[model samples]
Target: MERDPPLVLDIDGTLTRPEGWGIDPRLFDPLLEWEAPVVIATGKAFPYPVALCHFAGIPELVVAENGGAVYTGDDVFFTADRDAAEAVAREYEAAGYSLGWGPEDTVNRWRETEIAVQHDQPVEPLREIADGYGLEVVDTGYAYHVKDPAPNKGDGVRTIAEHTNLDLEEAVAVGDSENDVSTFEVVGRSFAVGNADDAARGAADEVLEDVHADATLGVIERVRSA
Candidate 1:
């Protein structure tokens, strides 16, 4: 039985359904009440799910923008690898791919590859670049994202652990998409919930068949079992 700290979980498709449907409050309740910290590592913009965390009473670190943006309740840590995101975004745009909401520096995205392009970008061209990078490109049917090198979930997990003063070997992360693979590989324990993609489920130590499962509840059971 290993006793380790719990750190973060992906929100869309991992915890609740991507659209915020069929979520069991019990699933989130434990995470909110847990002695260990449980954060949300998602591809959503800073505010959308950040607001969800607020409503759920979650105070753990938030790894958003696929890792480009890391938020702790009191502070937000933007990525340091500005060059990669900007370069990536630039390459995609030059290929005639339009982007979604971000690229604040516009150059940061072309330089560091820190942002996910879905809100304002089309899916086809985004998929083309995702393939070009040898990175994982994910389409939640709502958004298209680029998380090949930097500013990914795994990177976000590391940043979160550092911010919380938690040990990497003490944390657990679970996700359900290809974008989650990087973050999934960085944690001590990784699990794929029932609703996850095959790549994600294969990446985890456990594969759950409980679609519509509660991420917090699945984790609570793991706590007891572990």
Candidate 2:
């Protein structure tokens, strides 16, 4: 049998159920049984994807913090400076926003290379402040990430492909938000779920009718059949 192409996937809106934070139970077996590498690429903090990989019984290949961090099982790579992101967050806080998750925010506690501000917070102010520090603000739909402009999800995908000795031209990516646009651009084939934002739909090679984890499963089946 031919080997399946490597896959890069986003977490929240792409793999998890739309109604809640839980990972759709259907994804576990497919991930474990997948023939090629499965890379979890998300704007989430580093530890979150790492832990997910552990429990899912998959290899620990991850692109977390919106490409700010990459883990290839043996080594970890950081693309940006966390202090700069922290500075941006501090300035946003001084401007009278509460980081949107409250005083003891766990959302960004384990984050290493960037700060994730809650989506409910005003984005313009965060963007304005990030400009002064040479950082960029990206809305992942789940949150606004303040971080370095140099690295993105595409860069992380390239790094993973190189480390795994896989061909970029054969990789497949699936996602549902703006943060996913970079990965869509870098991979050979990309799918945007039905709930995907405009940016992701524009960047993807194909837009699926299914939403969330269901769409992801559909993509897997399509690839497997091909």
Candidate 3:
């Protein structure tokens, strides 16, 4: 029997390419038509994906700030479970580490725009942050993303499951970056887009290939079949 539908998705290369920060209708509108909850999961801040969700017409939930915050209807939830992150932040900053988010341990957030304490930083330091934190780092050739562990997309999936009462294993998660690897922990079907990072491709349940280079469509078709 088919399981419950996917309730979460990762942004950036998963749905939209770094060059195209906006929603790509050719890929995601169909997924939106599936009538399933599409929670935005990314290292970006709360309002970051809010605009994307608005653009995509996704009226579900969002796990933002790389699992640091969540947005649901009228309220915004920020987690204190960031202790590990806090530790990483202090050490990273003191080490003079460069972060995707900022000069220090800050997050550069945006949705059709950018916001941050200090948005510009060198890439080498960002990589160092990723290496030091055991996390994934995505640099869109413009922005920086310090993603959580192999449970990033997983945590986002679990968050969606919490409110929907859906079985964790039945959910699906998709992405095209090392950050997406974390999502594999929570879903039965974890997919990597054709353009996904090596770690993501290595860890996914399947890799969307052939003419289905479009990862969003890959996800939509999978749901339709389910």
Candidate 4:
């Protein structure tokens, strides 16, 4: 018998608009009814994704902080050097960057394995500073994520597949920004929503015409056919 691969989704421009403030209500039932494991992977902090999953009434696992960590219900799999991240954050602050933490926690406590900062501030200089410490900086929508690049969204999805006993090659990944590029590289079926950034669209196997949740639904329909 053929088994269904997990559905890995990216939030922000993929699930909701910058103005929507939440996952599209239209997706709730489809998500709750899906048989395969559903995973919400985002550059957002742990608490927000955790709360969103809870509200959606789905058993989807969450890979937060651009794959710097994985959260399954209350259990967490964090894999970053906090000491290194803190040092870098301090350096950026010293260089005159005003940083804002993610929605639920302070910059220092946003994620166990990564530092999340508001993207409205400068990041190129921060990236230069981060490189000296062997860390990579990624811009995920409205936030900048500083973490070990090895464990990215792709790795997060891979971990979820292993945890759920699904085949990596059968999985579907959808997103709309540079941060999702890593995920596009690793998933079998990779899609970039119409609103995706240029880099994200370039990295995807297919770019959907519809935007946001509509694009996500398009991916699901295509996957259902595959």
Scored by lDDT, the top model is 2
Clashing pairs in 2: none
- Residue 221 alpha-carbon offset, candidate 1, angstroms: 2.3
The better-scoring model by TM-score among 1 and 2 is: 2
Query: Which digits, one per residue and each the tens of the lDDT, describe model 4 over residues 1-226?
Result: 5555678899899888535356777888878877787889998776768888888988749998888778764467876656676778889988877666544546446467777677788889889988999999887676787788677887877777667765667778999999898888877888998888898999999998899988887777666633
Q: Across residues 51-114, which tens digit of lDDT does each residue of candidate 3 receive?
A: 7777767674777755656665545555524444444545666777444443343344232111
Clashing pairs in 3: 150-182, 151-182, 153-183, 154-183
Candidate 4 shows a clash count of: 0
In model 1, the runs with Cα more than 4 Å from the true position are 1-4, 17-23, 80-122, 128-137, 140-142
Q: State in Å the error of residue 86, model 2.
A: 0.7
Candidate 1, residues 24-115, lDDT tens digits: the string is 55666666666677778877766655777788887747877778778766687777444444566678889877675544633123323345
Model 2: lDDT equals 0.90
TM-score of each: 0.71, 0.96, 0.68, 0.87
Ranking by lDDT: 2, 4, 1, 3
Candidate 3 similarity to native, TM-score:
0.68
TM-score of 4: 0.87
Off by over 4 Å in 3: 1-4, 17-21, 72-75, 80-121, 124-142, 146-151, 210-213
Relative to the true structure, candidate 1 reaches a TM of 0.71
Q: Candidate 2, which ten residues in sequence have the lowest lDDT sum? A: 16-25
- Measured by TM-score, the strongest candidate is 2
Root-mean-square deviation per candidate = 5.2, 1.2, 5.5, 2.8
lDDT of 3 at 192: 79
